[model samples]
Target chain A: MFEWNAYLIIIAAVAGLFFATAVAALVWAVKNGQFSNLEQGARSIFDAEEPEGIQQDFFPGEADEQRAKLEKERRPS
Target chain B: MSPLLSFFSSIDPKARPGIPVKVQLSEIDESMRTPSILFLSAAVCWLVIGSFFALVASIKLHSPDFLANVEWLTFGRARSAHLNAMAFGWANNAIFAVSLWIMARLCKTAVRHGGLLIIAGIFWNIGVTIGVIGILTGGLTSVEWLEMPPQVAPILAFSYILIGVWGVIAFRFRQLGHVYVSQWYILAALFWFPWLYIIAQTMIFIEPARGTVQAITNWWFAHNVLGLWFTPVGLGAIYYFLPKVLGRPIYSYYLSVLGFWSLALFYNWAGVHHLIGGPIPVWLISAGIVASVMMVIPVIVTAINHHFTAVGNARATWASPTLRFIVFGAMSYTLASLFGSGMALRDVNVVTHFTQFTVGHAHHGVYAFFTMVMYGSIYFMMPRMLNREWPSAALIKTHFWCCAIGIGIMLVGLHVGGWIQGMMMNELTPDGNPKYTFLEVVHALVPWLFSRSVSGVLLTIGHIAFFVHFFWMLAGPKISRYREGPTLLLDSIRGEGKAG
Candidate 1:
């Protein structure tokens, strides 16, 4: 007789659907270019403070030397 | 991986954009310095405490009477205490530190209200302290993941909101740029965790959902805490640190989008796999099983993205202590999650359910995957925040090896042993009786259980070494300049990173 609870399942489905719908509505409302310029967000975490080519956490006496060396190596001879 | 792709590895990164001068990195670091240190200190302290509790509980498995006389040290109380202490005390505190720091950095904003954030952190730790104490003193609610007494709920809830609100604030005021994938994860996690926490507290205890609904809700909450909560933050850290440390971008932007949304969609429904054999609806269990299997998509996407990104950067990954731990954690994430999907299969779950196998899986995911990522983030963040290299490279190496080996041993002992235990327990005698007695099962698990204790001791030793190194650096006076190079794992690999 006590095999399973159908009511509980229905409640769960309803709650999930409600949240999904709410999220969809929120996404529709915010047309603020949230997903635009995809690459910019990818690279935005980089700053001039520690530029991409220069590994900030690297070893060596001077960070500038590491960058200079890398630039020189990658330069087209 | 790189030797085959050696030609592509040296492709000119000169095509990449010069760093924009939008945000001051140092200013961001300065703003978060005090709070990050505070949270990390608390996390390490809890790591030690949790280690103690874990050792006690593991010992009880092999030698129950070892602490039989001590009331607070009984198996139930000790296990519960360890879970709460590690989950709330250690893991959450580490998340607060690294996740917030990463969010602020990605948002390109200095945290505006540092004082309030610190206060919220204090309250969060205080709440966890009280809750752990409650569990030890017999106030456990006996729910699987929500074992802390009912009274500790509000304190945790309030503080969690206060801390989480800062991530939202940072995102709200984020610089006008493309929002990075890490931001998506941190933001989702910040919101998803609190909703799960509050709903769990209410449904499971406060206003009891009758019968198996409570049990279902409990598993749903418990499972998703790892799925929705820890997994997102861990993956986000990998996304952030892997690229940053390797000096590259992720392999594909589309893959990131695929990984994030698929995880969100599938992981929510996957929690019911925890209740497979229990008296839940079969349809519900089936839905959960499908979702768990579907998790393979995001897992594969993440693995490909990270693996390609790290291909040419193997030397760089090795040179930096941060990436060493991170690479290990990222690999663990892929392994454990895939194993988890398999474990959720009905056939597998039948054998593994209520066995030590499930316990082994928990550590595989939480310790091997999540905790190690947090440790890497700390390695990355601490030096930047303090503006000084770690005090001792030797100690850092010690920490890494100890933790790596310890968890490795743990994964093997528990999984292999648990599988054998499950098989033996499920075996039936020829005359239609259970073959293995409960006592026989116990006797069989002794060696594996002893290995777990041994692993715990190793982990505790690592924690002490880490504790000493971290506090030493935190307490030491800041060096005025970088006259001496940042500490390196090996000066032998001269041209790779240690150019000087």
Candidate 2:
């Protein structure tokens, strides 16, 4: 029978393990350049230019271009 | 519109396929700036209301006679007013202003016809003003947090729908790409708040749920409002601010994804933890406790990611007002979440519940963690909106110190006071009756109360200073200034600030 005390301890241990793995993965991501540009990521959608060497593959068709034109016309002069 | 087309458009454009991305003011393309200005003004008024109510409530704790026992300004009404004004009025309005900016930037679209949003802002202000008046007039519904009376509640809810419709429309017209973390939080908060608010109001106010169910439901509603609504917005801010201030990318996208999913799944059941040891069923409480402790996983993950993101960039703590508030908020989040989980333990709650400890916990989350993060967001945002930097770094420094010290002192006083109160309550007399006199507990808290008031004064001063700076910034005096390099002391000269 798993007593409440034992269950709690086990759960806590599992939580600790999960936390460790998460931290390790985070550090790995940081090294891999996940957080290199904060403002750029948030603003990328609005700006037309791309970061050099980074290729964006979204919006591959004419409708996308049409929407872009509509958005452009709405911009403040 | 075809169903498929409608669905595609309905999906937030921020989720559309990739485009070239860069961080610049130009990226924040919006059709109208008026809604943002209106929301900002609302935020300032709400800040005053929230802090003033907080002072009233805090003062009442020590001397119930401080205000001559005014019926309308009773502790019950004042406390609820303080929290609701802060959460709904101040925090939500600020979120509206910032989210509009972020959504437009992320979606790669102008806030298509945001003129409607300005009207929505006007409606929101009216609703909040009426609601606060209702609370002060003893029109409270007797529920914690959701205390607005029926007459005021409908107005508030209606206003929310108008604003929410804008958010939905904005999401639908967004440029396509993978949904970003901030988008997830904003949209989820928008959706979850109405669902929770409306359902709870209907069930509690209209239908009148059965005994104990109401209590359970009240706790459920209160906790979720914090978790589902405020927490998402706060985290969304952290997601934005950490990278922006530090000039880095989030450390781990995969980890963030996991953190989000785990949080959504684990956070809902956490409301039950507040009911621990209440008349609620043991199983329900146990489930809540489990979820509370399990929250450690998400909190730790967020903490680690945020902390490391600013490791080498810690110098920015002094340079950037936004970074200072945000970093402080991020640290507080770790402590509050951990503290919450600890309090979920039966041993801790048995003593700490129904004491100043609960008050401490509430402020720790709402003010120290949630409000601080929002402050950071506002600081980061205002310059962009006003097209001018803050006029006085001195005022910002003063505000930061006052708030930081004020909250620190208040939390410490409350925690110690509550522990003593809890211990006294647990004592038993030889006759098997309660041994501790209620007066004894009350008397013990006197010093703590005085300390709390002192801290309240500090926080109030900070808020007033912030208001003055904000007002001056808005008026556009065109003050000639240069950055005073980061110095250990205000008077001392140091090197240049990083961003400056």
Candidate 3:
């Protein structure tokens, strides 16, 4: 029975260590300004830009036609 | 402007007006192409192999005499093979592919050692192969979830180290300033798995813990395999894909933080529930019960976050193969977790313990929740990796319906039948005799076992369809070319917007 209780102490120590590590990570994240811009964090994956000199249109297929229509709509005449 | 500079600019709050969305998502595709395909292909092969083993095991449960003469085909060996194949062979491989790609993309860094990843993946599969064969050949350890022979463990561990460290290295060189919630999950899972595996192996196999303590260690390791490893990776994929597909942010960032931290803290302690009604002390069981119940906070928080994000985009979600599987999985995660908490209660545990109810609950978590989410991630990742759309939307639809129906029938049959079996076992006649004989209980499960076999057959059909469809997409010259855009469920909806 004491052996089992000894195992419990190991469990407690591991649990305590895990809790400390988690708290430290959380503090580090907070201090590093990781949580400051939640909105920007969400949009970060979409930050990849279309390669330069390629069709600037984000939509696939009919890119040239779409560019022409945009240019015509923006003309001063 | 260069994509790298634009990436940094986009993260800066003040420079938003000048920031251009010029980063070709294809760059991510190019970087991850070779490794992702290699891992996914291996995972699909294992899915088919594992499904066959599962059908064999399910059949033996109801019909004991079938294939009994073959030494290698015994129920014990076959079942162990099936479990290891699915867990290590299919699930782990899929996780490596999907999570690594997600990590690279989110970090804005190309996977540096593509050739090394492929080599590690090949070794991982080889290790699983040798381990399964060892179990069949009478080298089995008989430990639940660790049945893979001792000889194979080192190889698996070494290969896993290679792959796991790759993810951290990618993160170390990440271009992004802010780490997303999904990255935190993936990173934690990568780190946690090796620690859990090594410690469990040391205590149970290496040092040999004292009698019941071996059982304690077993439960701890088994439960953490599901909770710490599979659960985190699945949730991380959900956190990434759901928002990406929906073109929106999660409902509440604060809730996500709470969900991640609470799960990390509570789940590790909850595995002792498996020891209930056994020789372990009452305090351990009580602690497990409390922690299991505490799981409600994270489960509900994740459920709400996923629900509110997808609720408004019902049409788009249904129309995308990726979102449909993911949403199904996200919902199953909520249901399975709630049921698991309920099962930990003594009153419920009394009836559910040592019954098919536990088996059904296991599938509900591992298959319906974890495997389905992995399937969704595969659908999302493959197209990007291969630069080609799925060959046939019909095959995708067929795969989904078959698995959904198969697991549904299996769960209902097992739970209802098992509950009755448990109740019957607990019944006592006058003078303290079991109301039913042992054979009678076994006899009663026959029909439920048969239903499980049928469900296995259906699942097998789904696996074959998925494998063939994937192969056709990969090898067929006509469909292998890079498609200009993604394949959506409905042609009418294609090119409409980025809603997919």
Candidate 4:
């Protein structure tokens, strides 16, 4: 016997343990309100400086007027 | 219509569907700079080294005697060295820089002990350097993903834990509120990777599992390293950057949650598919196939989430280099995962198993999907971290086009070539003899392998441009204009502005 059966048993036990741990994580995530406030969670990465609406990235050759216009639009009035 | 200097059509910058936040990115960016610079600089050096090894290995496949005079550059050793260098060297270090920075930003917690991370990164790089040299000098192991000698394992594992803990610490002290989707992906990957690595090392190397257990364990570990470790880190970066660049939230938060959990649950089980037609139990193989097919749910879910978010912003995605790279990578993720699911079927596996088809698919996932995503992250992260824009937009464009075209050529050549080779090998004479002699098949594959090598050269050129551009920003003059302007992709290539 190559102890194949024993290996299977160990595999089964480990599988059960992982499943249980995954379930626990899911439960904790749900209970901790991790699943709530769905849209707000999506927006949480933004900030006042690099605020959400304005596109922060662009090429350097913007006409001076266009650049000034964007800077003005981005400022909090 | 009177034209008084275009009085009526005022510039109304189109606002993307975006979200607002409370904290300053500058504070978080400052916290990330110390550790991230060390990780990223080291990663760039490794990328160059890995690219060299990759070119050498690829060349040797078609022309075996090309480097025959040098023993270390033999195909077997060179190929393994390339994989180890890229995997442990470039990819892991990039993840440490990009994913960890994203975690800290989303966590809203400064990395408390930044010095610890620098130390861990040093040791990790040192360990990889040693392992790579050892592989070249004939200490290579039989294990697939764990090819690094037994001595290198402990150093990598310990250092990785120290580095991974910084992420966990940030999560622990996170501002108590909504856990962003990016944070979920980052956190899960951090926890999962170390566990998978440690278990794999113990089972296959430390104690040495017996009989068929070793083979099974090897595939289990190797496949999951891609599925659970690299895939999550790459996906997490995509989720974070897409929104930041496009100024929009993910299309559906609930669907993101679904995508994440399903990926975590099914991916680990999918590893056994690598052992199809092996001596493993039929039931085990079936389990793997089922899990791999089930992966389509999350892949499609993620694709929809990202595509819709970036749908109307096509022009922006093209103009902004960061968005350009990220979107390409995201699209590749969908293609690679679908191709993977298809290959997992019994009939498909029978054809693709040991052929160049598998090799092509590996690059599709690892390079096209993961590596490109990392490139996008570097382009985004470096400007913010250095407080300066990229030095040359032309070079960035060069890097992107070369890599995109290179990998595309590679995929077509390898897959198409492999399919023909596999069919010829499988052709049986009436007496069940192989129809094509092995030498004939080898002769047939020369052109495809040469195409792969050609792609490697293009990729190496792209890599060099990226490497030079990275340092140029860090070391170049500290002019005020370059400091303020973000390098973009719109300017005419010849007469580019001061950012040139």
**Residue-wise lDDT of candidate 4 within A1-77, one digit each (tens)?**
33765665666565566567667778889999888788788887666555565455554343233344544544555
State chain A's TM-score for model 2.
0.48
Ranking by TM-score: 4, 1, 3, 2
lDDT by residue (tens digit), candidate 3, B164-274: 887897677677789998998898899889977987887778777676777888898899899999999999999988877655577787688779988877788888999
lDDT of 2 by residue, B92-191 (tens): 8987887767666555556644666788788888888788888888888878877877676677788788777666666656654455667667776777
In model 2, the runs with Cα more than 4 Å from the true position are A1-77, B1-32, B429-431, B477-500
Kindly report, for each predicted structure in the order presented, the TM-score of its chain A compared with the true chain A.
Answer: 0.47, 0.48, 0.56, 0.62
Candidate that would win on DockQ: 4
lDDT of 3 by residue, A1-77 (tens): 34766765665676567667767778888998988888767666554232111122112343334434534443444
Fold similarity of candidate 4's chain A to the true chain A, as a TM-score: 0.62
How would you encode candidate 1's per-residue C-alpha lDDT over B179-206 as one tens digit per residue?
A: 7788888888998898888888877777
Residue-level lDDT for B191 in candidate 2: 72
User: Sorted on lDDT, highest at the top, how do the candidates line up?
Assistant: 1, 4, 3, 2
Better of 1 and 2 by lDDT: 1
- Model 3 alpha-carbon drift over 4 Å, by segment: A1-5, A48-77, B1-24, B478-484, B487-500
DockQ scores of the candidates:
0.25, 0.03, 0.14, 0.26
Query: Cα miss at B412, model 4 (Å)?
Result: 1.0
User: Comparing to the true complex, what docking class would candidate 3 get?
Assistant: incorrect
- Residue B283 error, candidate 2, Å: 1.6
DockQ versus reference, model 2 = 0.03
Q: Per-prediction count of colliding residue pairs?
A: 1, 16, 6, 0
Instruction: Report how far off residue B421 is in candidate 4 (Å).
Output: 1.8
